[model samples]
Target: MSLYLEAATILESPQTTSLKAIIYNPSKPFKSPQPKLYALIVETLKFQDILKEVVENSGILKLERKLTPLLSILLTHDLLLTKSGIATSSGPLKDALLRHKARLNAEFTRARLRRGHADIKSLIGAVNAEHSRESEDGVTKTATGLTSFNPRWVRVNALQTTLEDSLSSPTFHAFQEVGSVSDMFFFDVVRKTYYRKAEILPNILAIHPSHDITSSELYKSGKIILQSASSCLPAIMLDPPKGSMVVDGCAAPGNKTTHLAALVGSSGKIFAVERDRRRADILEMMITKAGAEGIVTTLKATDFTTIMEGHPAWQASYILLDPSCSGSGILQRVDWDISKLNLPSSDTTSSHPSKKKRKRDETLPNGSASQPEERETKQLEEEIQDDDTSRERLQSLSDFQVAIILHAFLFPNARRITYSTCSVHAEENEHVVARVLNSEIAKERGWRVQSRDENPLSTWHRRGLVGELSDLKSSLEEQRRVADGCIRVHRTDSLGGGFFVTCFTRQVDDKGQFGGGIGNLDIVPAQEDKSRSQVLGDTTEVENQEWNGLSDEGPNEAVSAVDIADGDPRSGKRQKRKPGKAQQGRTEKTNRQFQKGRKGWS
Candidate 1:
């Protein structure tokens, strides 16, 4: 009956009938202490034999900082009280548990427990706070209740099939039958439709179409993979500076690796490295399934950072770094029932019912977007919260991104490097981009940007991750403009995941320091009010005069000024329009640096 007695029982049989009973009990609120914390404590106690053996034999007297991660669990679960608990060779399991001690101290936990209880009824009530999926039949355009959305796509490898040929396949027809999806416009002439982000479709799931594109059939193989369209951009950068060899860091799941392999074709070699053995196995299987043999070589190389030290071919022409990122970009799943709370009674054995559907509460839509008053009210009250937790996650994820970008350069002669993440966070996108460009080594290595027109279907842009990307004065900005061409892509505007990608090239001919002296954040000072003789305070349009007599380094080979009238293509004067996706994305991240911070989709 006592808590300690029950704890002992749990330790005796980690997989006892009683433990399962508590875990699956819907009516029995999980109110006594934190379950996650308690569960970990019981697990450690259950494995005491092995732990004791190691600890005793190792001659370790007291546990301290090194054992903190393991010790914290016990302290939190109430399994071991400091002064009253068993004494080991050292003292009680207390000191080194500093970080979690304050958190798990019984007094603190019980104080916090005044209002939080997790019984079957609470669980059901939370999920069914919205409409019951069992009751709702029509499709909802908003993904408000969804937790995960898995969008479908196709990968077209030239060696296997051209985009045009693949679409005509009988298999392609079968796939269409499985789902009702419109053809993606951003697709290449041969294959792929950047469908997910563009959200060209109303929802993530595909309704069975009247006709279909079957991917599995005779004369057909898995070479054409079902991949996320957002994952395809890294290889697309292969459109230029075709490399002789490439490296895919963290290439497990093989989709991106295979894309690179396909881009390089048979003549080029690709090294796909995965450190985890189990994941490496999966990668190998995917590689085989996709028929990417001879093109990609899978490696279980742990020290990829130093892989180049041994083999001479370690120096690659192109390196693609798709490090692991949070799956935050995924559309939510369908089990979410955001309306209609369904509380369960105390004795209802959780049986097979909760698995089928947990009931829940949901938020109602604010109003019509077309109505200004309604939209304004909704904007103020229904605005999504970008809390500190989400921001921290963005920052942590960006750190990994920055690390990978910096590491990509370790390979010698990697002329082109493309960095991308499915994250819309500026911390992950522009911040990382900014930090890498500012690095002394990146600058010294002669790496420059390859900016291009991004697709118009991403939210990050509307939020301002693009336009304010880099002031034209920064070397990275100039270099990127030279490479990728500075086109912004928006998920709302295009059919792909909210993704950020840009290419870079090493100075090929060692040009004379990129046009002598370009200032930081350069905006050719708008023309001095030539006509009115008024002092121009930023709004004057300078003839994109610098564009006319561009050096060989410029976009074109020709150097002729066009005769101009207002808004004419021949006119040197640049017409102003709202900032494209790129500009919008930039403004979203940091606006005090720019003017339009208030126009955001708040």
Candidate 2:
């Protein structure tokens, strides 16, 4: 995935570069044996040496890396199969692997010896045992086949068909069939140890993590989506009643939008709004693929904030707001070919430090690059990081976020509105919730955090952190309840990534105006400076670390040093950043500092 992204603008972003590469990869399923290509890339990337020197090595082109790995791993794993085929350290497999160890090493040595003009077709033939002549050339090798390692978790897309029906079909039988796997020689049959997700989320299945279910017929037909158990929380917590109306603010690449469609069924109405035109197109495609055209209305290129009174969405009984944020809690998976794993110099310019710059670079220990372009990208990342933590940025994002929620609060029929983010940062999660709770709209409409006991996900072991609620105006006891009401998923908890979600409910009086009628609130947007100062007060704690969605270091991992919150929002397990230039701008002062940085540091 990273190799294909070499020429793209997303390559410079430290966040989600690998994930985006996979999503936008040309080899994805499109009625081709692209699944095989995907498998080949995934397995080959596990070998760290090959990935770094050959694929991620900037000296190579994007197309070259893709072609080389296909011939190398795919062909080798295919022809050099054991009797059972699966590459595991078992009785027969262990013996087979030991037997081929010497020969496999020799082939890799040969490939490296002729790296610049290596004939992949010929190397593939050598690896496949096609040439008896090459076999006697004093080469040692490791086991040729690889054991596939795929994480378990399957989401039943209730829109296309019921989970029961899909599981009962012949398509599911492949899990027990040895030959059905992509590699014909692989021996271990996929396990049938599928367990229903605990609690009210009946459609979610937690299968044994080792099984490869991506190629199942149900998955191919969109009867099931490979979503994590945690990602399905927000929609379930919202619990939108059947035949009701709902709005999915920030609903692009619509997983929750379609989930809402399933709950509402054909009789219900859903307005799926996305701000970006391109992502909206993808959302529309997802909606169509999920068979939710009748239930979901695609509001393409429409910002949730622009949605106001008199719009059909204003009458929605429920709203799911999952706005963008620093994706700190997002799980960082290592699977890309050209990753942030290394900040290499582009051919056009050298990223290495000069004699003077080497001295300047030593001042900042965490700083990684010396190249002007690389430094510029890092500086922009730092600025964005700074801005996100700055009271100004948080307040600005909070105001817009609160406005979106407040807008939902104004809905005449709104009852349950759930706010979520894939960010672990408090500003976007707890702080935003606290800010909205203190607003006049919340007070007047009787909007309060839904108690955990009432939420379907209340039984989840990892609830919201208590410390983040310190800023909320509620009593400590109430704050604890509010924290319990919120659902938090850790990145390493086997959910797709870190996430946070909480639902708000309004109790209306006998007066119809407050009960179910759409009433207007004259809200004056708060000044940025005032909002910042008010939200942060006079504390150094306000300057929290920005949560890069792709960072493996989670918020909870740093809880001892910083009291940052841990959670996620959205029912899709993870949220992706909207398309934009990742590298923004650089300043001269920053450049001068990098000019004195040391070489070999980055």
Candidate 3:
């Protein structure tokens, strides 16, 4: 706790503030931006972690699930407000925190420092000295891992050509085959690059960021795309049939749309829906660039739920629902002023700035605090739009997500549907699945979890959590089966951040019938069936509530009243409960009551 406070204080200092500006804002240039910029970003990321720790320990800021990316952004501003700084002066972060009344209790911060916690004075002194040096000479000791840590991944357009063919071509002479792992052979385009990930996909290549291939013939020809492996999982898991129709419910910046197009082939059709007109334009461009315009139809500025009965998309066999989430899975993003950097140059160059020079000092880091000076009040309102990480906001997002999936469930021919999110929250993942399964529509239409044995990515290893499936109206065995059906990838797995994917399928005899499976807690063993019935029958004298698992008893006393029923002479010899109409009806009635009692579990 003290460490977090100290780090926050250091990050909020005016010296750190000036250093951040000089490093991030090119207009406020300083000599030799490499070392100082790297140090500044590293320190900012450290402070981001510190802030996360503070939020987790504060115990007051009850985040719905995990901290939303927008909340993280706001928290950094609050960290600045810990002491007097520009971020504290009525800016958007401060304003947002104040508006929501979400600021941390001061007792958890500066008060800890005043107490006898382990001293952070030396750490503060060191950071201050480094900042002072950077301000003076615009240089500081560089941190490691910046170069090796950040890598660019490229996915080959399977519809165009194979990875091996692309690598063998004269245009890709600079690339070499990566080592054999995951039975996936990757190509390293940048020689001497440090390898971490073995494979993103069979066609995707993870390479060093130094390579400049954006202008290459292959990229221009739309034979390769820059997409992370994690983002590619939904399309892969959906495994749409060759001639089937599919819907990308929240399609925008259509990376997955093009990938789905390739999978479905030219004979198949796709309905790409996007609510935002501007993003829809970009999606259209990407679809065109990928040469999928023939098969991919764009539903520009349209909400997916509005596609009602008799609509062309209604007949689709597969639907991919990648709704708007908190985007907590994104590890990092690099943003820069492209117009300023790529402007025409003087002297003897071919128009635009030299590729090397343009790329220089363009390493703007994300996944941490933003450039404080750049993201003032107006920008915060524009960037975040609202408090996306708040409990109310999460509930809203979850409700919207549930509505999208439920609407998709109404599709008559929708045989397979994949619901995916970049969020790690149960409210959006397992809970959503449970809520949908418990819905009258899902039960009536025979929608249930597509078992792992039936899914393509069943061998991916990491599965959904069982603990989060407690609210689902299914037996423990069925719950475990459903958990195994879902897939989860952590942010640190190097597969392009955290992600969750689960496929829902409909069958003639889908076990999703309401009041059939109320979880395992209500089940009775065959050996105890007769005794249990006798106990229930004899309990006319004793209240039903008296038959709990156990109650306080002395050493010489019996553990439970249940033992008396087992030893009763009236207990039937037949151990099995007869599967007759009378017994089944009674069992169903009991289950209904049990389910009603457990309604508050979620």
Candidate 4:
């Protein structure tokens, strides 16, 4: 296949997969050189809007029946924007495009003039500036086409080195230090700069996204981590005391796990639980890389809900629950917007007739016209399918999120718990918070939303939406207070992405009991002959037993009815568990009681 056709096929890939991953996939290699193909796709996407307009105005797709919308757009991009013209052999396809060279050039010049650019260089600069603004906003656009500030947030890993030592290291020796994040946001494109963000978050810095820091020695040594400022909020908000026991309920890809380790120091211990074996491996690698192997215990394939009274993590005083939800707040790639380009319609009839009328059955060199049209239709359908965020999906996600937090509440010694999500929806944020706060376990354990004045992130201006908490059984004053306690980061706030975090706190008696009697809440059966010491020592061991659970990564993972049925507020039915060796000793009565208690939480 030609480069244009191959690049078009790559563009048709699902948005969930990263472009780099598709380009560099070793199993299914492309005909073109990977680097050259990747560059062509990226550069073409950068000028997609301009090329779309130029091609449509020139009527190239209409005149040349063989050229598809995507093909015309790609070929036209190189023709007008790149130093080298079309990178293809001299064929009928080339001849068709070359026939309209004069008209295409005129349309390209017209597009520049329409955008108020005096020259091509000035126009290209404007496009780069616009892209920079979009990156800073993290792809969230306002009504006025303005976006929030989104700088590349970097955290100095305290486990390996201090922030001061990192800044003075050889990796950042050439970088000019700026006074504010805004300075870095509007930095001179040619100069290297960074801004220290100490006012709200410590050991964090903001740098322009254009700067490539992944290759630096600091990053390679794990002395620095590429985490968003919003993602760092939970660890900072929990504020676990030095040498405290903590649990990261959904820890994987362990950015927050390592941050918690840095806070607890070598004297503290953290149990990072991840149910998925694949993600657990990634979490283990991150823990090792951050030099936190001694501090964090990897609980691979163990569900947070399974950590009952007998489990080692049940005694954790501090817990951070960043559970699964619709990742609507996550920052998207700026280049993904290129997929929404309005290419010229392929059905438009040609104004000029052929010199000698040829039969319509004669296929073009690439393919028949109908083939490209079908492909275009299929691509549009895939785009729409991938973007689906139906209300039913959100409801399912909210139910699972509420279940995770309620399970965290069951921890006898969990004094402080912070529940967070990178979701803008109230169904996953304020609604889930309200549901958990109103749960029977929370009421029995005295778990309540930590007041704003006591929260570590109280200085953050954006708070939870009080209007979304109308369903909560609280007075208007109380609801407002609860909303004020939650910290919300808007996608346009430039703090990185849209995020929501709220801390829950309660008092415990000397015997690790809240003021109420222990109810008959027999959820999971206690493990026999296991002590805290034994469990803690077995941190390095991966559990071979499989537990049905959902991934906290995002909405992509499927939610098992058996795993979340107890906490799912709307699920009225349960799936029967298949009898296996793991269920040998369990009686039917105990299973019934477990199911009954699970329904009570909802």
Candidate 5:
């Protein structure tokens, strides 16, 4: 098929299939290169409004019966916007498009003039300005444009390279340095030129959102990571000591896991736990890419709540929990904006009255009958308003969030834990924090909110909303202190997205009485105690064995409990396990049974 036809097919795809997935699908590959196809689609969508006006005014769709609305838009984009005309070779479609080239060009110029532009250049600038404004305001469906106030945050991976070395690298040679993050917000149509070193977070740099840093050598080499400032707060707040063991409770797509690795250095060990198989694969890949494979161990298909007394992760001194939430605070995806474009229609009533009616009643590609134009537009408007933060959903998420944190509190060796979410709702943030603090485990283990004065993010202006914590059974003064300890980033804060994070700390004595004891140890049955002892024995044996890196089965493969060991905690030394066929067979069986139980939790 022609490039125009292929582009049209992709544009007409149902909302269920993302534009990227359809364009990049290997099974149904396009004749044209994927990158070229993607660029054409994005550029066309950006200029679609003006192109739609031009096409309708020129009456090309009315005259050309063969051209679909999507086809005409794609062909018209190439014919007018691009320097070179249509990319396809001589054909009936090409011949037909070229036949109306003069009229199309005239209509485009007239459309530009109608929009109050003196020339094409001014019209382009105006459209770009509107695009940037809309992206920052996030008031329209196409809100996350190429340029916006939300600066692209890049963190120099200390595991691979230092911030000073990364800045001196050739990747940033063309860029000019600015004094503040606010400077990165100003959009320049020609090019993105300025970058600001973040004062609030170490090794973080904010750059113009328009700059495609992923294409840089530093990013590809894993020296630089694209992570939001809000997401980085949890690790910074936890500030795990070097050589300390840490656990990331929900460590998939591991931005915080790798950050923790960077802080702990190679001497420290990090257990990155992820219950989902697919997401564990992603976490492993990220850990490998960030050059933290040595410092970080991925716990694949392992639920955070399932880490009992026998698990190696139970010995972690620090834990970071970023649990599932409504995701109400996340920035609208740029691809989502493009996918929701309102493509111009080819079925003009003037040309074919019956055909227009038939098109209205036609079943869409996803098998849903098309609605009236008015209803469709209204539905699109409604979709722009996020409904995921409904009361029922928030309460469910709050309960889950409290449960995850309560589990973290059960860690016998845990000294600190940070709970965070990409949610703007109070129920998921302060409410969950309050609920966890009020739990019996939290009070018994002496897990209290780390004071604002002691937190590394003390200088950050935004703190938790005290009003949200009114339900807590604590003094107003104590409630205010807890609220002040928490950090909250607003969606419009220019930190990239809405986020909430708070640290909890408790002092541990030598005997581990106040901070180290498990909350419900007496409630467990005798049979369960035997199983726990076996699990601990198998884990200890694995730790004493050779310290080889990820298994030969590839990073995505689940790392069995018997395959990993933290070594003797007191001596901090590796001792080879005594060889015995019967003992090895029993250990293997136990590991398999333990894995089965963990999978069942998922």
Candidate 6:
């Protein structure tokens, strides 16, 4: 996940040129005994990097500093590995790290000599405290080989498959007794886990040991979709009308776009927009596969800010925006290269001092031509690219989010817009929402938070002011309140990816009918009838089975249904349980916390 770390750091902006570097020279996962990478990342802050520079320029100095350090910690320690491979620090890994450490100390010493002693000392103190946390409460390896697999659950959509059908297959035990409202299930093997959902496609399930389901017959035929419940939250909140004009502002590779299309059935018009041409092409393929080609239109939109300015393809009544962000919300293992554990011996290369270079050159705190300027352009480029900067991308991205909000609310008929991201950053999520809601444009347009709850009838009166979101007034007056009292989902919560979604409707205007509103299309009878058939067919079969009871006649009549064997762990357990599928999801959600992205808004 250094990709997650490097991506966050490049966004930081610095006032002075302090060289910062992350030593990831290990070509393989680090051997055990490697000093905490978290501390190294914190210490790296002593040098300025492109990430820090961008963040400073964006005026999120504090966030840049805080997030970059955390990203470093996550990258160094985490490993996305197979069950058989347990990484540890070997001699080479240790030596490379030690050499890198030496270079950083020397750099810090030189930097201290040039700057304010107080500032330098404060940074060092922060680094020390961060390292101390790692030393004391640092993570340790748990189960492996057989134990490493977490029993992540997957759901079969109610519209297609039944929960019982997904679980009746062998290797799964019924914890139907331990479930929730989202129609989720758990494997008997791995306990205590944050479940993964299939977000974009269909109601597909993940097998504990099976990772090749994507190429299977069912997935290829569109019988199942791989989507996460967290990813499903925004569309849940927006609940776009079945037949209306909708705009997916950042719709590329159409996850939410297809979801919106599915929810709308076939009557609605969904314009799936992507800025990148290649991504848009891929999105079209995805749309075609999902059988949603007719209802959704694909476009190569370079700037969503001007989505409505010059082009008049569709006056969007609803919009879904899942903009790019630092992938801090991802909760997966991180693995490093084994070779990075050790540095090459001096004799391995030339006897000259410069000939034996340090791995510290792999990354930098700040961009500088101060040393070997012209000769190392390629090296610098590689280093810069390694650090993915969200601030630079977000400078345009956040503005794009705001611009989409403006356009969504531009016409009186465009009532619903769901602004969301995979980022946990408030600057990208809540702040962008606040900026638009507080501005005169949103107010004059008469767009306000449509019920904060997905239930539509649930209402709350909330409005925004500039100083901070907390100062704003909500009809219910809660600190977590959005500008118009919209619900913003965090990765720290159960369902919904690290995202922020706010549904809006126009409040002031009565007649702005020219723009295409959701009222345009009458419900398509055929689409509804097909869904009704799916439900009725399944239900009727189950009812008929129930009507035919098991028999007890003679020795040949002995039946072997899936009754629990006495040796099974849950054989005798009984409790007041919730509905099987729904209960499984709700229960797991409560027990497991949200997966944190390596770095975030804080």
Considering every candidate listed, which one attains the maximal TM-score?
A: 4
| Candidate 6: regions farther than 4 A off | 1-212, 301-313, 336-396, 454-497, 508-602
For lDDT, candidate 1 versus 4, the one ahead is 4
Ranked candidates, highest TM-score first: 4, 5, 2, 3, 1, 6
Best of the candidates, lDDT: 4
Residue-by-residue lDDT tens digits, candidate 4, 49-94: 6776677667778678888888888888888887888888788877
What local lDDT does model 4 show for residue 203? 91
TM-score, structure 4 vs. true:
0.61
TM-score of each model, paired residue for residue: 0.47, 0.54, 0.53, 0.61, 0.60, 0.46
lDDT of 2 by residue, 304-359 (tens): 55454445675788999876555645543333544523322223122212233222
What RMSD, rounded to one decimal, does every model reach? 24.1, 18.3, 25.0, 14.0, 12.8, 20.8
Which lDDT tens digits does candidate 3 get at residues 1-602? 22223333334444522333334343533333334333433445433333433344433234332333334333443354335322334544345344433334442353224223233332332232222211211122212111113245577787787777777765576555555221121221115232334332567766544454555666656687767667778888899989789999888767788889989998998988765665665566667667777677777655566564435776798999888766544443332211221111112222112234212112222122225554333222322221236665556556766777877877777778899887666677888888888887677677888999888787787788787899999899989999999988754344654578899988743554323232222222213223221322322122212111111111111111111112321232212212234323432453344334332111
lDDT of each: 0.41, 0.52, 0.53, 0.67, 0.66, 0.40
Give per-residue CA lDDT, model 1, range 147-217, as digits (tens): 21223344565657665565566555433332223342112221323232323211122221111223244
lDDT of 1: 0.41
lDDT of 4 at 590: 30
User: Residue 267: error of model 4 in Å?
Assistant: 1.0
Query: Residue 590: error of model 3 in Å?
Result: 52
Please identify model 4 stretches exceeding 4 Å from their true place.
1-143, 336-387, 507-602
**Greater-lDDT candidate between 5 and 6:** 5
